[model samples]
Target: MKIRCVIIDDEPFARKLLLDYCSRVPQLSVLGDFSNGLDALSFLNHNQADLIFLDIKMPGISGIDLLKTLGNRPKVIFTTAFAEYAIDGFELDAIDYLLKPFDFPRFLKAVNKAFTSFPIEKPAISLNNSPQEDFLFVKDGRDLVKVKLNDILYIKGQKDYVMFITKNRKIMSLMNMRDLEQDLIQKAFVRIHQSYIINTQHIELVASDKVRLNNEYLPVSQTYRLTFREFLEKHK
Candidate 1:
């Protein structure tokens, strides 16, 4: 199946360039392109897309603001001329940030990263729904290792892999942060930053900007600060 996509940018030339790039990739199907966030928002409300190529600045609503409005946001690739917004974009877990005037090679690189999360042949790893099972298998190199839920202290995301830090050992897997976040959140795991997710049960302390888990400190990024705060309230 083709991965459905939407492009939201005020620049006609930019949108055209993205369109041209999408056409060359057989795995991508463009849902539509819009000149502003409002129009794109309207289209997205009724339609389902797997990814969005968004601009940081637009007339009606900035891309950052628009992203906040999406409850079930698709994987986003922020396209902008401004370098300052890179931090803001990543805080929201964007797939990649594309600097303006990017060539096809850079665009293709981002698309490949998107495909790693949204594979055409199969879905990412998922937790078993059975209540009795407390462990999930992770693909580490040539072997699939069984890792208990309670054993995980935290998880760290690398480019295409996540290192599962447990009390005794660390297991590496070929997984993306977004997929793992969705699966593990319900199992007492909370994403504290783009690169870190902590097992709440192991949290030793919570500071203003960081959480201490298993004698280690992990930064709580601005994007997840509110969510983590709410989690603390509910559990308290």
Candidate 2:
């Protein structure tokens, strides 16, 4: 089943990054996004989102607080820059915790880990075993690396080549996000900047200007921020 998802981050760049990743995956449809918890809560009462790509800290309501307020809980992946919150987030039964400034491969690992329900690892999300469009082959040196779609965090564009960042590592190749996304297992990837594609699950902070990935940041051009907000709402 396609995971209907929502994004909640105050950062504009962060929102755009997630949107770009979602565009690639066919199954991970974003339902909405929100800058604050209250706004997101209002929408959730009327709509249902399957997966939540949530940020831990915000101005009004932190992500953890919002999650606590809700009874109709969806699968949650917490994003944060501070390692101190890791324990707290996991204590809330978060599916996974992603540190900021994470590359696609690192982000992928968290998602893949989150895909497997903890304690039992039941209700697993596996691209290979699924009956739908499942796998993708990436060019790695002289060999073709077959990557399960769910295992990718984000695809980054660098000049003429693209970097396929996976859960385990990165593989650079002569490819484009446009073409690679065509076969992406889910639409959870978003292009927040011309050079960066981000996995929504790993976002640490969101602002009107740039998305904070831990200490590092990415700029959100005016051209992309507005639509990115709309994208967040859909997933929410």
Candidate 3:
């Protein structure tokens, strides 16, 4: 599905950078640009954007302030010049917090996050909702390894290699992010960090900076921060 998005930032260069990157992403179409938060608020009344690239330290109303004022919210990815404000942005449930001078690779990571998040759309959960499946078939050296989904704690991507960490074993394979995500996503899987994908159910605890699953620690990326916060709120 195509994601309609809007850019709201004071800096001209920042807006251009976001616009250029959005052009490269076929799924994203920039519906509008606002130099100030007030203008953004006016645009919001009529425009329906699936995602927003927001600047934290803007004149007039700040990004955090605008977020609070909005009645309906699209997923937010904060872009700020100061690293100190990153924590506060996440606290407000921003999908990702991109530090200034971010590159295209980092920007791409944040955009994909909007696509995978379930909060963007959910239906009534009925008693008849199908039970979550428990396992998957993964190709091993010569045979298909029936990797129990619950047994898996995390999967790490290093260049072209994919490493699977489980309760009983660690398996390595030659794969890319797309291939791995296709095999495991929406089936007890979530990409918490840039180089890591974890089974959220196996997560023992999710701290501010890292995720503890079994005996390993995985760093959560800035882009996936909001989703992590939402994940924690489901329990509370």
The candidate that wins on lDDT is: 1
Off by over 4 Å in 2: 118-236
Poorly placed runs, candidate 3 (over 4 Å): 118-236
Worst 10 residues of 3 by lDDT: 120-129
Give the total clashing residue pairs for model 2: 30
lDDT of 1 by residue, 142-168 (tens): 355778898899999988668999989
- The lDDT per prediction is 0.86, 0.68, 0.76
- Better model by lDDT: candidate 1 vs candidate 3: 1
Candidate 3 deviation (Cα RMSD)? 12.9
lDDT of 2 at 205: 81
Error of 3 at 165 (Å): 23
TM-score of each: 0.52, 0.51, 0.55
